[model samples]
Target: MNLKVSKEAAEWYKNEMDLKQGDYIQYYVQLYGGIPTVHPNYSLGVSIGKAENIAIKDVVEGITFYFNSDDAWFLEEFDMEVVFEKEELEFIFHKK
Candidate 1:
């Protein structure tokens, strides 16, 4: 599925979060809307529904990319609050 990410996001993951190509970065949407505590890593805060996990695939500007649907359940139902793992950077990862 095609996911949309901001240039800011890509850079944040790379520079601050040490993300690189082929990294399996995790993206989850806030099912509801609310403000999260500020952090140096997430200075812009978070955007709900900003990252969507789709069932198909493609790449384009204004889109974020996910590895694949191998773990779709975590995104769709199981791991709803994956965003809260930011402190440990546990929810996201690079393929390597």
Candidate 2:
């Protein structure tokens, strides 16, 4: 997929996300609406879909990049309480 990441996300992907070359970075890209799962509930949170992970190849966008299952599942079940803007950040590194 063609993930569109913000400058902040790009920096995270390059640094924080710890992405290598082929890891899987799960993300719930915002296409429709509602605040991201990570962000706290907002009067203007986007009403998109449930959070999911995207392999490095599929992750085209999102802010919260998960490194392990705990992070991924926590994000997947994140309550709308944190108000952090969402953007794409590649985190998953696929194994060859």
Candidate 3:
């Protein structure tokens, strides 16, 4: 699995989330309310926190974006790319 964050997306997050260089962005599986490509009735969630067991990650603009080991089931079979589009951030999943 791979985690990729586009430069535009990283800038968007930095500005929108009011984050600094050392901040951590975590991507996790949430119950609902997003356009999820991997699982039905599920979606991705973003938060700022330190990782305990990072399975995959990408650093952009000095911010660390990652997925925890416990969320492997959601990402193990796909490459995730976060991009900025239409003035918002989008999550795209490419099946491995």
- Give per-residue CA lDDT, model 3, range 1-96, as digits (tens): 889999999999999999999889988888987557678888887899694788788999999999888886788788999999998778888998
lDDT (Cα, tens digit) per residue for candidate 1, span 3-39: 3444444555556655455444443333333323122
> Which scores greater on lDDT, model 1 or model 3?
3
Can you write out model 2's per-residue Cα lDDT over 3-85, one digit (the tens) per residue?
23344554555465454544444433343454333333421221222244433222323333332333333333322121125
TM-scores, each model vs. reference: 0.32, 0.26, 0.91
Which prediction has more favorable TM-score, 1 or 3?
3
For all predictions, the C-alpha RMSD in Å is 12.4, 12.5, 1.3
**TM-score, predicted candidate 3 vs. hidden true structure:** 0.91
Give the TM-score comparing model 1 with the true structure, all chains together. Answer: 0.32
Indicate the worst ten consecutive residues by lDDT in candidate 2. 42-51
Which residue window of length 10 is worst by lDDT in model 1?
Answer: 37-46
lDDT of 2 at 34: 46
lDDT of 1 at 13: 52
Ranking according to TM-score, highest score first = 3, 1, 2
Question: lDDT at 63 for candidate 1?
Answer: 36
